[model samples]
Target: MRTEKEYVQWLMSVPRVGYLRCRKLLEQFGSAEAVWEAPAQELLQVPSVTRNVAEEILVSRQSYSFQEQADFLKRTGIRVLHKKDPEYPLFLLQIHDPPHILYVKGEFTLLDDKAIGVVGTRTPTNYGVLVTKNLCTELASAGVTIVSGLARGIDAIAHEAALQAGGTTIAVLAGGVENIYPPQNSSLARRICKQGLLISEFPPLASAHPGMFPVRNRIISGLSRAILVVEAARKSGSLITADQALEQCRDVFAVPGPITSPLSQGTNDLIREGAKIITGVADIWEEYPDWQANYSHKMKDEAFQLNPEERQLLETIGYGGVHLDHLIRVSQLSQGEVYRLLLEMELKGLVKQLPGQMYMRSSV
Candidate 1:
């Protein structure tokens, strides 16, 4: 017997049955199986279900096999979460145009609560990179799951930082969960699937195009409790995510950068327009005191688990931040080895690299 999820998946495949129409049908018929078995005349009775949509639904059901779709999901380790499913993202359900089904890879349960989205320009400045790494690492260390678009630059940095901190993250894609866009982030995507999740609205193997990102942006913001804009130009896609977040009534935080920098334009504007100014994780912690408390012990435990070399290195840095040369000198390591180990530690989320090649122990 086909599951209700399979039936919803089949209904989603029908032509002209986009999210709104599908929702209307579901409300009318009570279940996807009932909707699928309903006659064309009855389908037409549902609000906004025109003759064309009703006829298309009837015709499409005869051609598309639910078994085939289920088989594909099983083969690829993909799961379809219907809107009514208990495991479906609660934040997403409150959005205006929530997708009827989410094609997901990896841990869907990670999205149940406590996520923050990090978004910015594809070509971020060094300042953006540093800020994204520090904030994401701190938040992840504090038990907050980072959410992002899985794009290059800031998004990639956010996901990597979260993973390095041994925290959960979610990559919301514009394409199919099976198809990683940009091709360059394939390895990162695989790594994310192991510790976090990869989610999409498109079905398996569906190619992503320019038009899909706006819709994808909504899901990115929808899945999170807040959105952080690290760096964005006046017309960046990160701004779109921020706008979507505001519409969803989620808090938006912007990192203030040098006013002279081109990359800071959007975030600066956001600050001017009353978005919260974020200097560190404390700004976020003020809003999520409970989350901060929950992860404090975990962060300290992870910190204590570091090896002798790492612990020594971390001790040398202290809380005030140390220059790279000082860090190497104090740790008694070669310059090359210091850089290599620092990078490794940065990925492990034990350290944060600041501007001017300085390093600091993570504040978590």
Candidate 2:
């Protein structure tokens, strides 16, 4: 017996039943099961369901295999999330055309609700690389989930930085999650599955093509509170993401780059056109006072049980890791005192010690 969800999955699998068409069918019939039971004439009554399309749906339904779909999803460790599913991102629903179905790998937590899309040219200048790393690392360390397409350059850098910061990230793929594009990022995609998430609107194992990139760009922006363009040419896909962000009523942020560089033109144009100019993570935070306040409150809550000295040390350690020598100098505490406090804090699980005697707040 086909479950209601399997019926919806079957409906999605029908030829020519794109996101909009699928949505229309659901709206008209109230459920995929109802759509399946409806006669060809009834299916045709739904907007955009032409005679051919209705007939195709009927033909496809007879051939579709729910068990095969279930086995594929299980084999790939992918979860099929419909728009009506509680796990579907609430922000994505606000977009003009949210994908009716998302194939997701890994987990989505409440932390993902605070996300920023980081996009840029696939071939970036040294300056672009630096800016992307700094901004993404800071944003991730601040508990903002970094969202980006799993392309080379800025997107890969963003995901790497977030993982390095011990923070969450999400990769929105142009292809299916299992069919990682560019091939070079296969290792990175695997890493993301362990620490973050990989999501796509396409069926699992579907290979990406040129046409799917622009369509994939919308979800990158849709899933984020804002979109940050690090570097882009006068004509680039990054601009498409920024445009989608604006259309979705999400904030668009751009890093100002040298006017002499072609890579900077798109971002400069965005800044000139009233997109927020992001000099640093603080600039991004300024637009979301509630996020800043909430982060501050979280820090305070975590420190509520700590003594003054411990709290001071934790504050000094900050979000990013700091060297023991730097902590001692900045805290103006004796080497022996700093060492003793760090050991105590580590034991308390409030701080984590990294390679090179670096310390960072553990909660982030």
Candidate 3:
């Protein structure tokens, strides 16, 4: 067997055979080598095969030797992963646009782990840097792998924090496996290769370009269970990733900030639309009870599960601890119903009633 990786390299050499086209052909033909060996007339029989694409596959098959391609890959450090490989990301395979092959560099195990994407503006404010570090550190300690683009600001801070906390992270780049954009993160990229994973969908030696980023966002969300936007302007590229994550049916979380901060606009808007409002580590920890199983004593040490009506009352408090009157207005469950739910949830460790009867999400 020419192994799927070798076959994918052959398929990639064929001009105009993009991710989707390659996937479709493989599903129809059964294998990349099968498609390559199929006569041009036979190849065109598969759906969506362009007249030019079919011809290019024929020409390239005869001229491009597998050994030459292997040599090229070695020189550029691009290791290809085919769908059949055990190393392929399990979550990515579930997505509609799964890459036929991922051109990866650095450690591959990070792809197989449970990861959460931490994204935000490229030029982060001081607050963005602090939040990015704190949350990633918390998440990492709780046994979640961090995922992010290797761009500047918040992304860099998130990656660094994961490493600093003695945890692994993954950087899904918009360029080739050998390329790191924003240029300045070269040292950080090197550290990630040593401790985490750095990957891309493009071939080795391919330069990073503007349009490739939107395509790159899918991989970020595709690799994560949820995405946490640390800070974004109204028009940040992080918003693009958030939208893609929603379409991919992943949870979206945003930290609330002061209204006076311009960088808070996107996050505040996300909260208004009912995205999960995140304040501290517990808000995220409770959302994934599976983590509780392995969570250090600090996380599982004090936790409780709430019933439906009680859970509704707890949500009324929101992330930042809403006051009693405001929480009642927002919940709309009436005082009697609210009081009962609150009492049950508070005893269950889901919420705490402050001095003024305001409720807050419990940390313990």
Using all chains and alpha carbons, the TM-scores for the candidates as numbered come to 0.75, 0.74, 0.74
How many clashes show up in model 1? Answer: 1
CA displacement after TM-score superposition, residue 187 of candidate 2 (Å): 1.1
lDDT of 2 by residue, 1-364 (tens): 7666777778866777755688899889888899989999899888899998998998987888888889989988988887788878888888989887788998756324789999999999987887787677666766789999999999999899888877789999988888899799999999999999999888777788887899899999999999999999998999999998999999999988899999999999999999998765556667886766534435434433577787889988987999999988887889998887785565334577789998887652
Which scores greater on lDDT, model 1 or model 3? Answer: 1
- Candidate 1 lDDT over 304-354, as tens digits, reads 366777778888987789999887778788998787677656644567778
Clashes of 3: 0
Worst 10 residues of 3 by lDDT: 297-306
Stretch of 10 with least lDDT, candidate 1? 295-304
Per-residue CA lDDT of model 3 for 252-364, tens digit only, reads 99988779988889999999988798766667777888875655535422333345655566666765777777766777768877765665454334566677766787766
Winning model by TM-score = 1
C-alpha lDDT score of every prediction, in listed order: 0.85, 0.83, 0.79
Better of 1 and 2 by TM-score: 1
Q: Which stretches of candidate 3 lie over 4 Å from their true place?
A: 13-17, 20-30, 38-59, 72-78, 293-363
Order of candidate numbers by lDDT, starting with the best: 1, 2, 3
